[model samples]
Target chain A: GESVGLHLPTLSVQEGDNSIINCAYSNSASDYFIWYKQESGKGPQFIIDIRSNMDKRQGQRVTVLLNKTVKHLSLQIAATQPGDSAVYFCAEGSTSNDYKLSFGAGTTVTVRA
Target chain B: IAGITQAPTSQILAAGRRMTLRCTQDMRHNAMYWYRQDLGLGLRLIHYSNTAGTTGKGEVPDGYSVSRANTDDFPLTLASAVPSQTSVYFCASSVAAGVGEQFFGPGTRLTVL
Candidate 1:
């Protein structure tokens, strides 16, 4: 879906497990991608971002991998803590388009202790 | 830092009414954006301004209008409110567009009756 009005996909995982959320993008010109974590009743917080020029980038406990070949992106969260439980979103920004971002349908991560 | 502030944290409006959602950013960023969040979908851009005095329509610009006459204020106006327009609206500003991190307002939850 183009807007964030679609149903969110959900994933249930045990605490201390690894979580992987995937996103598919349609625009190949997207060069900058970022993963955001949004808790209930709050705005999205920046997680990690990767450039199309680079295949991968990592933050403290998160990693973002971009595959320009197939227009795919994935976010990996290691040691998925309960605090990490939130809606994970993948947003891509097109360098060719003055950095306008196109967001993907979010995946809700539920970490059960 | 009160980076961004949205007025009337939440509001309820009647159908066919005129309503304006206000967003302000103190970071002095050059770009401001308005997005409406629904249940499970991605954050579709309603409208964006790269700088003061300019605005552009986004994917879901219908039923919404934006104005950026100054560097600090970007208000979203709903000509005639409808139930379909009820959602949590977020205001964001970035130093630059793209992978540049965007600072978000707390968000205004609007419900149309």
Candidate 2:
């Protein structure tokens, strides 16, 4: 079955450092992708998104890079802070499924002070 | 705006019991979705509604049902809950299906004992 997956289950970054979380997807038909941050006891919140046509997209303190050839995606956080610690998930969406999203097993990012 | 609202932040139910998770969106989006988040599985789509009065099954829709009676609500029902159904359930809405961003609600955590 087509699925989205992450490279690591957990990541630790020192405060003021940069953090990167990697993900790989199995479906070539996926045209849209998104990154979400889920804090403890809270629902996932949108971080950034990119379309298949584009390779990268940037938000306030986050950047999402998509490598269609390798079916890979990554989210990079700049100047990691304590508030940035959370479970990060990458999701894929395709026209075939009406753009419905399929999420990947998350990567928990912990910002160490 | 209360982008999305879910009922009963948490629950503990015996197996074979029936449960209904209510979701409401104030954004008036045309697309609504139900997803379950497990420890290692990430978020899996359970059901979706593109508009009022229409619904569709998602990747893991078994043992679950949903209805979109109006533009503001989409409720997910479990006929006979099982232990395997214990997870955090989330409701999200988008301006339209297959495009744009999705706003999520505070999830409902269910434990089927």
Candidate 3:
């Protein structure tokens, strides 16, 4: 079955440093990708998204990069902050599936003070 | 304004019992979705409704059922609770279900014993 997966399960970074999270997807037909952040004891929140036609999209301090040829996606945070500690998930969707996203296992990002 | 609200913030149910998790959105989005979040496996869609009175099964929908009585309310029902069904459930809604961002609820934590 086609799925979205993360390369790393956990990432620790110091405050004020840049952080990057990587994700790999198996579905070639997927055209839409999104990144979500989930804090402890809360539901996932949207961070940013990118379409297949575009290679990168930026939102605030976050940027989403999509590579269709490699079936890879990434989320980059400009500066790590204590509040940025949470689980980040990458999801993929396409028109063929009515845009129902397939989420990744998630990467836990911990920002250290 | 409340974007999305889920009832029974947490629940502990016994096996074979029937339970329904309520979800309501004030945004009046046309698309609603129900997803379960597990430890290692991120969020998996259980069921979704493109609009009122229409429903579709998602990645995992065996023990769960959903109904979109109207554009504002979409409830997920578990006919027979099992231990495997113990997980945090989140309800989300989007404007029309394309590449648009989906607003998520606070989530309902269900523990089946």
Ranking by lDDT: 3, 2, 1
Candidate 1 residue-wise lDDT, A1-113, digit = tens: 33222134888989999988888777766778888889999999989888878998888988888778977788889998989889988887776777777777788899999
TM-score on 0 to 1 scale for chain A of candidate 2:
0.98
In terms of TM-score, how similar is model 2 to the real structure? 0.98
**Tens-digit lDDT track for model 1 on B21-85?**
99999888999999998886668789999999999987789999999989999999999999999
Candidate 3, B11-73: lDDT as tens digits: 999999999999999997999999999999999999999999999999999999888889999
Clashing pairs in 2: none
In order of appearance, the predictions have TM-scores of 0.93, 0.98, 0.98
Estimate, for each residue in B58-104, the C-alpha lDDT of model 2 and write its tens digit.
Answer: 99999999989899999999999999999999999999997678889
Residue A9, candidate 1: how far off, in angstroms? 1.0
Query: What RMSD does each model have against the real structure?
Result: 2.2, 1.0, 0.8
Q: Whose lDDT is greatest here?
A: 3
Number of clashes in model 2?
0
What is the two-chain DockQ of model 3?
0.90
Please give the RMSD of candidate 1 to the true structure. 2.2
Instruction: Assess the local accuracy of residue A91 in candidate 1 as a C-alpha lDDT between 0 and 100.
Output: 84
Q: Which residue pairs in candidate 3 collide?
A: none
Global lDDT of model 1: 0.85
